[model samples]
Target: MSPLVQPRLINGPYDDPGLILDFRHARRAILFDLGDNHALSARELTRVSHVFVSHAHMDHFGGFDRLLRLSLHRDGPLSLSGPPGFIERVEHRIRSYTWNLLDERSADCVLAVAEFDGTALIRAARFPARRAFAREDATPPDLRPGLVHDEAALFIASAALDHGIPSLAFRLQERMRVNVHRDGLAALGLPVGPWLNVAKAAVREGAADDTPIVIGEASIPLGRIREHALAVGPGQSVAYVVDALGSPANEAAILDLARNADQIFIEAAFLDEDRDIAAARRHLTAGQAGRLARRAGVRRMTPLHHSPRYLDRPDALRLEAEAAFGSEP
Candidate 1:
């Protein structure tokens, strides 16, 4: 099955931590953290429809201004989600700028920001680009657990971690993956075309078994297509975690949020030699990140946010992580 999200690291571990999740098929993308995102082109920036923040740390949010400027005149509304104080942070950024000279030239652009406490959205606000980005309180949804944001194709869940302040780790999972078997299609004598997508959708949506599926000159039941050419199973999942302390509470939260994740992008900001410093600064070390990935049973681990202290011995972190992950050098 084709992946629903194609994620790439925006910067090296020594720089800042950021990830770009390209949902190119949908013509939209999601940004995880707002660190130095200059690596992404203008077209890529404009494709970002939503941004997920891990915390309010400067490195995690420094790219907000760039994102705002890039989306200032875009047609679609931009949304931001993060831990508590997210709305205020965005509002403060907006207030820092003056827009008195701007008018209807860019009147339709809007920005929505939501603050989540664990899984519940505590506060929400919207800023209209045309109106100088003024804050407007919006109705809050009922307190929910597990899921913070939901979309038709996938859902995002969060868990609060200890960063001295609350930090959130996010998990993005597709609803379900529907794949078409080429052999089955060949057996059914159906040509591979756009109609396959319809069949896949039918499988994803659990359409009625007897639903008609037209292909070329003949019509077949959706069930026939499934039995012949469609395969459905659990969808793709990726987790993003950063700036979290290595503590018992944080361990539990990270494990729960990132459990069974296909890929875990976490902070390994220090080496085990500086474990004390990492703990003091509320950040994870390479060993700790590997331990979390192991305990969570994640398929793969991509450690990031390495501290500058390890610049001279970068391989040490990778070795430590690989050791904890039970992989040979």
Candidate 2:
């Protein structure tokens, strides 16, 4: 089965911390942080539907302007979720820019921002290009706690950790995976088209087997397709975490957020020998990151956000993380 999301690191471990999750079935993407993202193309940033920021640190959110600039002329809304006080920060950033040239004829795109306080969004707002990106109060959606974004297809869960401040960790959970059999479609004389998306949604939404799926001029029962052409499988999830102190509270939060995730991108900012420095900076060591991912039961882990101190020995971080990941916590 084809995976729905393709997660990739936005920059080298020592540069900035971020992830770009490219969607496989649609022209959409989700950004896990807005750090220096020169690595991502303008087209890629324009397709980003939402951004989940870990914190307000420069290394985590300095690239906001690039994303905003790329989104200005787009035809779709750009949504963003971040830790407390983030809504104001977004507004301030927009305010710092001159919007005198912006008008209704400019674009219909809106910048929807939400501030999540660890558990759930505390406030939300909308800034439309038509209104010159002015801040307007909006009601937060009714969603379960810890869920920053929720939709029928997937949901984003977050857990805030201590880093001298709240640094959030996120898990992108795809609701379900739907696989289609090309051979079965050919045998049934059905041509490949957009109807497959409808069928996949039906399966994801648990539509009744007898539900009639209209494809072209003919209506087909979902059960027949379920048996001959389609299959349902477990969904995939990717987790992102950075800059959190290595403490029991943070560990518990990360473990819960990343539990059984297919892959986890975590920060390993220091070596075990630099434990004192890491603790002073509220960062994690390579060993700590590995053990945390292991305890979370993730299938694979990518150690990132390496401090420049080990630039001469890049492999040291990877080796330390791998060794700890393979051992018991």
Candidate 3:
């Protein structure tokens, strides 16, 4: 099945840690972080409906001001999720500016801030940064671990991790695997028609009603339509993580989500030579990021969030990380 979660690193090691996940097919697109979002213009920025932030660090959240300015008048609600104090920080940013210019504008923005408390293992979302919605204090409520989004073609799961402070990792999954049942269609003397689209939707929705399926004047009971006959296997899963340290407690959480991730995006803010510095700063070195990716059994590792000092020889840092993880340069 074709991958539904399209990930593009707008900025990071190559730029600055901005990712645009196009779940266009699912009718929703998500932006991971908001560092240097030069890759996304005003028009492109409005395309995203949700923004998941790892932290409030400057490099991680500097682009939010511009994003807010662009999305202030959009039709849809712009949900923003992040660590604790995120709402206050965002409110402060907004209050810092005078709304006299924006009062005339239709600010249809409904910002939702989700904060994770590691000690409680719970996540809470605050609407308008004041009103609290649902709260989960149990095992870190599975934010769509299974059929979370339930859109026609996509499902998304969000998991929290410790990045010095509270942080989160999101996994976007395509719910259905689409495949042509050539043999079944041929056996039934049924030429592939647009009705197959309805059947695929039925399979995804797990619809039980035996609605009559019209195929060129022949009405066939939908119950007679077998799923495996026209269905494929599982779809793809994409996981994104950033600004996290390699700690035993967080390691398991990170690995569980990243294991088998087709493309893993992680932060590597320091080099192996600066391991001590990385540890002190509660950040991950390139080598550590690579090793964790290998340990997690990720297929592809894109180490990003490099410190500015390595700007001159970024390739050197990348190679060092790959070598440490036993990956081909």
Candidate 4:
């Protein structure tokens, strides 16, 4: 079955770290970090509907200008969530640039920015390019801890980890996976079309079994479609973690947030031999990252954010992580 989310790294380990989650079931996409995003095409950039920023570090947020520029003419709103003080940082970033050419006639470059205070959303605001990106106070979502984005197919949960300051790690939790039974559809004399989406929505929304699904001509009961044409199963999850300290608290939080994830994009910032430096910088060593991934029981771990100190031995860091991943948890 085709997975709902297709996650790709924005840059290599030698560059800034980020992840882009493209929805196979939806037209839009979500971004994990606002790092250097030049790797994405303009079309793909415009498809991004949401962005989750871990922190305001230059490497993690310096690409905001590119995203903003690409989405200026797009009609859809661009929503971003991050740790506390995020709204102000985004405002300042926009304020620094002049918007003299913008006017009421221009396409709306709306940004809905929300700030999660490591628990709940404490602040939110809307910024429109036509208004010179001025801050307009907006209502915050009363979300529970570790949850920021909720939708029909999935909900995004975040954990705030310490790296001198709060660096967030996010997990995309899919509510359920429904696969179409080709044989059953053929038996039911159903043509492949947009009606399948309606059926899937009915399944995801838990609509009544007696609900009617409109085909080209006949209206069939949802219960018949569910029993014959749809196969329901467990959904997949993807986690993104970076710039977190290798402390016990962080380990616990990361392991929980990334637990049983199908894929985890984590930072292996340093080699095991340079663990002292990693501790000093509040970053993870390759071995530490691997062990944590193993303990989390993630199916796959893609390590990024390698330190330049090991430029001469790029393979050594990943090799160490591989070894540790195979070691006893």
Query: What is the C-alpha lDDT profile of model 1 across 1-329, one tens digit per residue?
Result: 78888989998878889999998477888999997889889889989988989898999998999999888768768989889988888888878988886566774778888888896888888888777777788865554486778866888898889899998899998889887798998998889998877877777787999999888788899998899888788888999999989999999999998999999998888888889999999999999999999999999998888888878887778778878877677
Runs with alpha carbons beyond 4 Å of true place in candidate 3? 12-14, 24-28, 100-107, 118-152, 179-198, 205-231
Candidate 4 at 140: error in angstroms?
1.5
Candidate 1 Cα outliers beyond 4 Å, as residue runs: 141-144, 180-201, 212-220
lDDT of 3 by residue, 117-234 (tens): 4322244443231211122222223443322233566655555666667676766666767666778778777788888888777766666647777787897766666543565567
- As a TM-score, model 3 comes out at 0.78
lDDT of 3: 0.68
Order of all candidates by TM-score, from best down to worst? 2, 4, 1, 3
Candidate numbers sorted by lDDT from highest down: 2, 4, 1, 3
For every model shown, what is its TM-score relative to the native structure?
Answer: 0.91, 0.95, 0.78, 0.94
Residue 72 lDDT in candidate 2: 81
Instruction: Please write out the lDDT profile of model 4 over residues 144-243, one tens digit for every residue.
Output: 6769888778889998999988998899988888889999999999988899989998998889999999998899999999999999888889999999
lDDT of 2 by residue, 239-283 (tens): 999999999999999999999999999999999999999999999
Q: Which ten residues in a row have the lowest lDDT in candidate 2?
A: 320-329
RMSD of 3: 5.2
- Candidate 4 residue pairs that clash: none
* Best-fitting candidate, scored by TM-score: 2
